[model samples]
Target: MDTATASKNPDTRSATDRGLPWAEIDTVLFDMDGTLLDLHFDNRYWRELIPDEYARLHAHEPELARQRLFAEMERIRGQLRWYCLDHWVRFTGLDLLALKVRLERHIALHPHALDVLDTLRVQGKRLVLVTNAHPEVYAFKHARTGLGNHLHRVVSAHALDCAKEEGCFWERLQTVERYDPQRSLLVDDNLAALASARAAGVEHLRGVRYPDSRGPAMQSVDFHLLESLAELLPDRRLHAYASSPV
Candidate 1:
């Protein structure tokens, strides 16, 4: 069934009122930090720890350091550089990679993310982890969480030199991944990335309701909402393949 038809079906409701045409989807693209993994680590590192570290390193007042860092973060908010650890190190004069390594304990997968991934894999769906994380950051997180075992491939925006917020990122991704937009589903925590994907002609899109485990749930206006990836699991009793523990 097409998405339009599935949307109109009253019986389609499950995790959300706007049910997806799961049967028609072949490729499932997932965002890394927020969608499949807990976003609290990233949020805490950037919002709290970075400011504190910057203050300590530069001998600036904590509040002042936060203000300065926040301004720089805002300046590159949706750009690829915002997600690049090397760019951040160069811009802030902070050893971000080292700091991330120090805080690797915070990196973790969201509940049931593995179950959903395993189910999709068992069902013969092409799974790709698409993230705006820098190559260095991706490596750090992947090493800590070992999420790579569950995915067919992982694509970082660093490789494309474009953030997922830009439609050109999707265009460039298509050249490399060669996914049929209509038959693919993208689950992301960022609305901007979803908008870009939609504009790039991707037919199926879903947004995470609660990206950060420590934060309140967000309402998604433009795409279907999911409380968790577990909602997409084919069977609640299905056991995921064993992998390196997070």
Candidate 2:
């Protein structure tokens, strides 16, 4: 069926169709860390580097320090404090911002991420990055990768004073970005965040199954998955988009 015909009549499409109605969607809300950039850098930073640094700085045994840190992290997994670098600096007495900058070489974008961003831009979609990463973290990654250049706007959940996993985040986000939930799509790796967006009336959502290249691809029980952003744009002309610098 023709694109126009299929877009107009949903009944005409096959049951197995995984295609999104781009004509119906105007705003695309993206999660920065895992959705656009590789999540391995974060996993390693929090799980390995921070623990080692904490042990070194506080004179605690390495294993015990990691264990203590993991427990604290689990305690606030979905809360705003979990994603706050300042909170960690105070909790661990370590200069986390400096450490993050030191490990800047590890930061990177996921496969086909640039192509997807450029394609969405060409489609005239209002791309907004809605991330839980602290502004400092986002600022560094933005400077490193120029991901912000392709986006129309970037909204950190920190600005909204809540984590994306919180149900209120979507509503609070609307105050800064007037995106229609019915005509918007949110792409994130966190299932909890996706659930919160759904609860806030977002009609479309997508999850990245392979946010951490080093880890096994994950499965989402509640949402369709994209192993790579390439799945979002299948146009053969995307080769041109991919060649464009971020």
Least accurate stretch of 10 residues (summed lDDT) in model 1? 1-10
What's the C-alpha lDDT at position 135 in model 1? 76
Model 2 whole-model lDDT (C-alpha atoms)? 0.82
Please, what is the whole-model Cα lDDT of each candidate in the order they appear?
A: 0.80, 0.82
TM-score of 2: 0.88
Instruction: Give me the displacement of residue 17 in model 2, in angstroms.
Output: 5.1
Off by over 4 Å in 2: 1-17, 234-246
How far is 245's C-alpha from truth in model 1 (Å)? 16
Best by lDDT: 2
Clash totals for all candidate models:
0, 0
- Candidate 1 lDDT tens digits, 1-246: 111122222343455543466788999999998888889899888987788888887774767877888899999899888888887888678888888766678788887787779878999999998999987778888888789999999999989888999989999998679899999999999999999999999988888777887788777667776755655765434423212122
Q: Which candidate comes out best when scored by TM-score? A: 2
Per-residue lDDT for 134 in model 1?
81
